[model samples]
Target chain A: MRAIVWKSATVLILIYVAVMGFLGPVPEREILYETIRNLYFHVPMWFTMTAMFITSLVYSIKYLNTKQESYDVWAVEFANGGILFGFLGLTTGMIWAQFTWGAWWSFDPKQNGAAVTLLIYLAYMVLRNSITDSKSRAKVSAVYNIYAFAAMVPLIFILPRLTDSLHPGAEGNPAFSGYDLDGTMRLVFYPAVIGWIMLGVWIVSLRVRIRNIKDKMYESSL
Target chain B: MKAAYSALAFIALPLFTLAAKYEPVTWDKTFRESGKIFVVVAVVLLILLSVFGYLITQDRRISKIEKELKNK
Candidate 1:
């Protein structure tokens, strides 16, 4: 029941963001030009992906402490959602870069960092699938998930800011502060992050439910 | 080598012309040159939302079936 309301709200909020972002006023910087409006879609995907990964990390910690299989399942599914959003973030960022930087996949610090971050999580998936025992898989993958999230923090959030890159807020560059901070971009940006995160949760919830049912069916078969 | 040079020259001429014609494009003032973007965004977003709505309904339906299976 509550899920229904949450999903509805997510839909409405995203629609608002899409509508506003398309029509909203944004400053046309010399280099960025009209493509600066991509700020609405691209930035929010990282926010949503980071939020989901944090949830995944928390569940990984809980799984370690409680040794509950359900917590482990939740951790895996949350990571899955994070990975899915990360793909969206990377591809959208690439497209935006093509317009602004004259290349689709320039070796930007942020871009390389994001690729490495995705690779770390992909290794986590590989680790999970290689183990046959559910308990061992859960335990081992929980540890890897924690490490993956730790790497993600620096990879996506910190390293990009520390190094020189085309991305904003880096060593010498100004970020969203110029236009994004002052403009009505936030009116849509904030809700867009919230909406995308909620949608991620909705997706994870369905996957988790399906997994639980599959486990139940397997046990019954035994 | 001579034929390859001709092929290279053939490619280079059009490429240079294209590069010369390339201009930095900027979006026009909204509602003046193109408010049609709003229409396109609205149409696409509606389709995306409907698909999302279907996923929600599928989640509920699957949950119902799971409950019935568990009860048995």
Candidate 2:
């Protein structure tokens, strides 16, 4: 019964967002119009990525404190989900950039920074694979996860500010202020973000459950 | 160590945001069309790569465990 309510609530929220997004009043200008549509997907992707990264970081810290393999597994699963969402965010951002900036990719600090952040996480995974001892792997990977998360800050935030970007809200660029979004648009945008974030958590939970099940099977076999 | 890394990353966000300046450029028609194609292809490739990578990782882990069990 609780599951039914939760499912129905999610469905209703999605429906509301869809209707508001499509029907909301937006500028008739082609660029603005198209970019507006991107808000529904692009912003949500970022939110989801942020959520997963935070989850990964939390588990990484927990593993470091407890020295438990389960925490390490949770961290890895969350990081995997984070990377998936990050890639989706990058793709969506690139699509928006192409239409708005007339380029597939720009060395814009933000763009390059995001790519570097992804690489750092990839390196963490590779490091995990290269290690053989279970305890050693967990310890080293947890350490790497912490480092990767730390590196993400400069890549995502610092480098972007030192240079110019085609993306909105850059230092010199005129960004969309609160006034830029009408109440109607906000109605859809905020809900979309929440819904997408919820979806991200759902994915992470499912992955963690699968990992736990697999671990159980492996242990039984042993 | 992971906490240190996370702290550094988080700290960099504000600085990066401060350094970034946004500049709007006029996009040409050809650029817009080609950009769309590029984005679509990139997205598809990313999805494919992720799926393939996951499968390979799963296969490698399963085989490694199987080998270990057999040896035992």
Candidate 3:
């Protein structure tokens, strides 16, 4: 019954998002109507990436507190999900950029910074694999996860603020204001974010369950 | 840990609210330029994600091998 309710809620939310996105408002004298559609895909990717990282950080702290293998598994799974969304976000953003910028790539601060942030997380996973001892693996990986997330702050937040960039919300860039967004756009945009986040959670939940099942099978065989 | 959570909430809430307030300008020259940057970054990000996924699978394999050795 609970599962049905959750599924229905997700369906209804998706429907709402689709309607808003397709029939959303467009300001007069705009240049890229088709490019506007990227919002549904691009913005949600960032939301999912942020949510996944938070989940990973929480589980890392939990592992530190309890030293439990389960917590470590949860952290890794969430981290994996984070990287997936981060990549998707970057891809969609690139598609939008190509049509608008007339080039495939730019040395924008946000672009370079996010790339480095993704690499940090990748390095964390690599560090985990190189260790042979279970306890040592969890301990060192947890420590690295903590540090990587901390490093993300400067890359995503600080550096973007310091330099000029083609991306919005940078220094000297016009900040987003309420007047810029219409009520109709809000209708789709908000729900898109919520739906993507829920989907990310669902993915992480499945990964965690798979990890649990594999562990159980291995233990039984032993 | 609590501090970190609070800080994230503080930063994200305002930014989200601000993002909600404005409609993203579409079809502008600058918007298109930004979009191009987004694509290039995304491709690089995809490659990075694949690498991470590979590393994770390797970690699982190593863990399995270690467990097997202990059992033996």
> iRMS of every model, one decimal?
2.7, 9.8, 10.3
Best by lDDT: 1
Residues A22-84, model 1: lDDT tens digits: 777776567776677777788888888899899999999999999989999999999999899
Clashing pairs in 1: none
Which digits, one per residue and each the tens of the lDDT, describe model 2 over residues B1-71? 97998799799968866664453333334433444645654554466456435644654565576566557
**Candidate 3's residue-wise lDDT over A35-118, tens digit each?**
555566688888789889988999999999999899999999999999999999887878777887765569788888888999
Q: Where does model 2 exceed 4 Å of error?
A: A1-8, A27-30, A172-176, B1-72
The C-alpha lDDT values of all candidates are 0.84, 0.72, 0.74
DockQ score, prediction 3: 0.05
Could you give the CAPRI-style class of model 1?
A: acceptable
Tens digits of lDDT, candidate 1, B14-38: 8866875574544447552466776
Top-down lDDT ranking: 1, 3, 2
Per-model tally of clashing residue pairs: 0, 16, 20
